[model samples]
Target chain A: MMQALVTCRGLTKVFGKGELAVHALDGVDLDIHRGDFATLAGPSGSGKTTLLNMIGALDKPTSGEVTIEGTPLSTMSKAALSELRLEKIGFIFQAYNLIPVLSALENVEFVLQLQHVGAAERRERATAALHEVGLAGMESRRPSAMSGGQQQRIAVARALVSRPSIVLADEPTANLDSTTTAELMELMSRLNRDNGITFVIGTHDPRVMAHSQRHIEMIDGKIESDTND
Target chain B: MNNFGILRTIAWRNLWRNPKRTLITLIVVTVGLWSILAFSMLLNAWAESSRQNALGLLIGQGQIHAAGYMDDPNIDHLMPPPDGALRDVLDSDGVAHWVARLQLPGVVQSEYKTLPITILGVDPAGEREISLVPDKIVEGRYLNGLDDDAVIIGANLAKRLKTTLGRRIILMSTGADGYLEEYSFDIVGIFDADQGFEDSYVFTGRSLLQEYMGLDDEIAQISFVLPDESGLPAMIDTLKAAAPDLDIRDWKQVSVMAAAMNSAMKSIIYIWLGIMIIMMSIGIINTQLMAVFERTQEFGLIRAIGLKPRMVLWLVTLESALLMAVGMVLGVILAVLTYFGFQGGLDLSGFSRAMEAIGSGQVLYPQFAPADFVIYPVLIWVIGVLVALWPAYRAQKISPVEAMRHAT
Candidate 1:
């Protein structure tokens, strides 16, 4: 009876045309409800990242549609999609992408700044986000000065600072060691449980799938299995 | 801070991310603008020198001659001295100096040779203010007074006539009786001028020439100088109203060559500006495009994080504008310093022959025109920003999906 946060119907994405065409995603039909901690697990070229791209409004599906809270993404302009991404959904990329020129605190404040939030509130929220990610005293450190795990944590802080509706992370732990990976998984699990924030993470790591409540396995652009733990 | 504030902060930081490349671009813009301002100043100085040199030789800012005097310089075309309304206006504050000259066509004979010349009957006191010849007397001295019977000839004429200071020469001209008359006068001075000028003119005391030629007080020309050339037209209008029977003309009308030089200098400045702009444009375009290309993944990352493409474009453009502004500030400072470095005047005396040929002085003085400061910097900045738009456009079109790719 939970409210559906996202719905995808027959979503497909093709990379090229004719003999050289690539079906990165084909006919993916799925539903993610509010407060769901979902994981899409797959190997390389299995359409998990492509699906994440579709859900995050970073790209358009060549056929079918993705609707977030019953509003179709295909119906939105680029500016509208950018607004949606800024205000509604947050993204964490595989590469720990923080703006290199900005410090850790400024990277976290960037999203709220884009949303035209007040400077005082933006700084307060950014500081709180960094503290929640266990990086309270390293606010002035640039990304280049931080380790891979710390940088990824700052990326997480940037994602959650604006308190968006859904958080989409692709390969969030791919660059961290085992100790850092375990710490990140614990932090994400705690945020989901305590905040009731929806999270859809794409990864091929089984450790990540075991931490999520629902696991969806994908291979060759199709979902092989969908199950709840 | 707001979106623009953050963008500006990022832009300022990113400029130094590649300090070497940014510094090179700054140098290009700085040197380019410096060259433009410096070249313009030099040309302006040269043009001014040409104007003053030509005018000071004989013509002042303007001249007043009898109706037919310019066409025929004989005694028949002479006019009486300025008085009444004419004298009142010429004596106004606008008129810096005025001198009456009884100039006429005459022949001079030395012990060895004879040649035709234009004889200028000048007052020693008034001529000092209007003519360069008095100050240019290389040997002996300028005329003593209106009654001093000794004459002044050019150095070239002195050479040709086998004459020197204290030598006597015969001067022959048509007197008031319309018949040729001759008189012997001592050569008291020899002036050094350009070759053509040295060979063409001879000077004597005004009263002495008048008495010798049988004219009481009639003069052929009254040339006047104004405090500023901008007042030449108004002064000419008043003089024409006062003496309607006489012809009043500005220096531009009296000397076609000077007018041509002024117009030509303007064209040359514009051409130099165009060349400098094109050079700066190429440098700016190359630098912006390279910066945009190198930051492709960064652009993608910002776009993915919800910045609109137009915002990315504005950010890139702002970076270029800041770069240009800094360079222009430094360029202006450098140009100003260079102008002051030669404040005493840039000596061109080594090329005196070429300088004199063009009616310019041996020393050229550069001036800083306030209008060029506004026009050149603003024009360069606007054009620099416009040229940077191409790279900014390229940055805007970067897809957010590109963020997933390996950045080079």
Candidate 2:
């Protein structure tokens, strides 16, 4: 049996208080195995992204607990959580968020720089990651100079350069065209299968759900369906 | 990247983000520092010139008079000679040059006009050694020998009396016994001294005044020049020990008006500096606050990426420091250019009389100690950083979520 890389038990996130209170996440329990490609599906206003944020340690759960590789995230210090994010988890955003001042290679190398890697080794790693995402000769191009899909590919290269244990992508193809979306999904799926890198993608896109090996659907801040493809 | 290196790069890049604003701020800072430098140098030059005029032209380094002569200097209170004991005291104190002077109130008459004036009787050769009298001869020549019976009259006094070089002037005054005494002097030189009073006075040999007044061995006062003004106290002690009855006065005592003018000029410079500091502080505070407002999302992103609250505060403070340093560098460059370009010479077409009254020449030359340039910019930099604290604190207090949600 594959070891569970992430486990959540009765996790709840509440915002504000009293009459203005919002239950962004309620009692979400899940186990995600190592090397799994999972898609979290939900309609707008559902808690799918919130759950992913919690699992990514971008936010905290108000109740219950979450553990990554048996280290409980709720008990971790902010510095420890930052270390976890830097060393173990990588993130890709739907908006293809890249520091406008940096070139594609520099954007990918930022994580390695933060990890205090040597400049030459960081460049080598960043180059390899960009090549793996099919952006080998475009390392010098800035995000604004690239297409949406190309920019998103650079974002993926940035996510994978540090060789993190899990890649959390939030609606990674929401802005790409159909052909570009297919190419991206295929690239991500290939990296997952070949490198044994786990992917936890939060999206409502049917295309994403259809391609994933496992799918979890959420509605009104609760899990509506959990299915294995 | 290393923290400080990253901070420096960001700061350098940030300066170009709003070039117009930065340029405007730099201009204000540069002009402000320039004004301070120019004003300080002008005032310093004025003070230096005034000191030189009073000490070199009129009072020398120190003066000696009858005990009550400062309050009422009358011919009856003339100093008695030979002042050998006082001369020995001044010599022991390392005074460079000493001269005895007899001051008498007289009516100086030329061919056409007569004017009331104070006649200064000096040892012609000793006067040249102790004062600027020899250099101030605008026409003819300075009095060379006591036996020649020649006098150097002020240019204005000679003009008033309608006298020329080699002309004769009659000097009449009351003697020590209150009887009218009269004498005639051959006018050989005329002096200006760039001062109104000095330009209106007359100078003759000391023995001539004593012989005319019928007090052959009497003197009005003794004056000496010292190398350093700081040595006045020791010099005064020596004079007191040598001649206990003779009163000694330093240049400071003789130039009260000059001292007051110097004090007022200094006060005005400090007040101007205070106002510039306040204005610069306001400008810097406003710039930092605007920066905070504009970079809110970027700051939020960094905070969310794991920078501590204190780090954010340090970042903002460092940014402010960097900005001030840039501004200060530009300001100092501008000030130095103006200072050296002016070559210490400032055209005083505007305040010529004020300059003249303070005994400075027409062109105001700014003089400043080296510390003034180095210390003031650093002080302004620190003040700029201190004023940036409000914006830095505000940045630190901003929550990541709130900061991300708000638009710039």
Candidate 3:
């Protein structure tokens, strides 16, 4: 009975129009509660990523509504949405999209810098975030100098540095090997348990699904089943 | 970190992301600005040379004459020497030097030839202060005093008249009684000057010419020089009020051709600047747009991480501004070095005939104006940043979703 941090009511997303129209999400409704480590799991064309993007406010729904803390996202301006994302939401991409020119520490501090954080506190929080993601001694390393797993860890550190209300990760482990994927999952689970940080991951991997407290299966632009462990 | 600090860090780092492109653009800006500064200075020197050559011929910075003297330089148009309010004004603070002369049309008869000429009756000491004719004596000597009773003619005129320094010549002009009066004087000096001046002018002592013309201290013109000519208008106004019957005119009115050339040179400078600005704008726009297009996904990634469109625009524009600023600094340094290289003046003696045609000296000295250092660089930078804004706007308009589709 935890209060919903994110709510989607009869959300729909269509990519095109007319006979060739592709419905990426059709009348989808969902709620993500606080402290819930959730995963949207499905096959390739199943609308899970689209639904995640809608929830993350990265894309608009064709109809219905998406709300974060009861504030409708459709009503916010682009700049307001950006501000909301900066203060409340974190993102980890499948490619580990870190700014190549920035050091690992700078990458972690970039969000706080955008929020106009003081230099000393931004450095302290970024260093601690990197340490929590097991990247303690690699603060000065650029993304190009690090391995795939190490880069993804830095991305995670960057995501968690600002202490956002929710983390939206789209196929975060899609480029990782089995050992690195299990390690990343364990790290996310520990963060979720200790810090009560909510996570919504989009993936087709069952190993990723096993770590989620709430597993939602999507098929053909619709939620086929929702199961909570 | 502060907002500008972070933006600057990213902008600086991004400038060097592709070193080759950055350096090439930097060179473009540097060379463009250097050429603008160098060529502008050269044009300025050319204009200044023309003005000096024209003014030094006979007109000083300004002149005073009887009301109708400029239209008709005869004995009837002469006025008494400066005194009263006119003398007080001429002797005031700003006037550097002034000389009164009785200039009249006449003919010179030498041993073998007779030719028409303009005769100038000058005070030897005063001419030394305000006249180039004093220094141009290539042979013999200038008249020592008002009572020397000698004359100096141009070398070319001496050649035409089959005469040389120390030879006697007969000067003839209409006297105060409206009849022809003739005076014979020994030729004490032969001077070399510009072709027109060499062919047309003769100089003698003012007292000797005045006595011969049956007048007492009468002068046809008063030519003066000021330390700085910016006060020429005010000085002219004061003199006009002081001597209402006398006409006071600045060198620009006295030397119409030189004034026109000066105006034309200034126009050419602005035309050249416009052309350079167009070329530099094209180079800047291409370089910045390429950088934006190359980093489309990176821009998207930042946007997804909560950077507003305006911030993206600012970051990109800042990058370009940094590039332009560094290039402008290097260009200014290069120009200053080039100017020092010509410390002795850029010699155009090899093109002496061409230089003489335009009334410039054999040596051209490049001058450094405040506009060269402050106005030009700041202008180029502001324009360069403005030109870069197109690419920044493109970066701002990049859709995060579309960019993410190109990810990995």
Q: Which stretches of candidate 3 lie over 4 Å from their true place?
A: B71-75, B91-94, B105-117, B139-190, B199-217, B227-234, B339-344
lDDT of 2 by residue, A32-129 (tens): 98889999998977887788878877788899898999899988886677678778888777762665556899778867776778878988999999
TM-scores for candidates 1 onward, in order: 0.92, 0.80, 0.89
If both were scored by TM-score, which would come out higher, candidate 1 or candidate 3? 1
Q: Which stretches of candidate 2 lie over 4 Å from their true place?
A: A1-4, A7-10, A60-66, A69-84, A140-144, B63-96, B103-119, B129-205, B208-250, B344-354, B405-408
| Among all candidates shown, the one with the greatest DockQ | 3
Best by TM-score: 1
Docking class of predicted structure 2: incorrect
Candidate 2, residue B71: lDDT: 79
- Better structure of 2 and 3 per lDDT: 3
How far is B268's C-alpha from truth in model 1 (Å)? 2.9
Per-residue lDDT of candidate 3, residues B1-408 (tens digit) = 587788899899998899998998899899988888888888988899878877886899999999898888899898888999999989988899999999999999987988999989888998888888889899999989876799999988999999987789999999998889998899999997777788899999888888998888899999999988899999999999999989899998887877999999889888887887888888889988999999998998889889998999999999989999998999899888888898679999999888977778889998777567778888999999999999999999998878887884
Q: lDDT by residue for model 1 over B1-408, one digit each (tens)?
A: 789999999999999999998999899899988888998898889999988888898988899999998887789999999999999999989899999999989999999999999998998999898888889999999999998898999999999999899999999999999889899999999999888889999999999999999999999999999888887889999999999999899999888888899999989989988888898889888988999888888888889889998999999999999999999999999999989998899999999989988778999999789788779989999999999999999999988886566541
In angstroms, the error of model 1 at B402 is: 2.8
Clash pairs (backbone) in predicted model 3? none
Better by TM-score, candidate 2 or 1: 1
> What is candidate 2's lDDT per residue for B133-240, written digit by digit as tens?
788888999887665588888877777777788899888888877898988888898887655765557888877778888777777777788877788888888778
Candidates in order, interface RMSD in Å: 1.9, 3.8, 1.3
Q: Rank the candidates by TM-score, best first.
A: 1, 3, 2
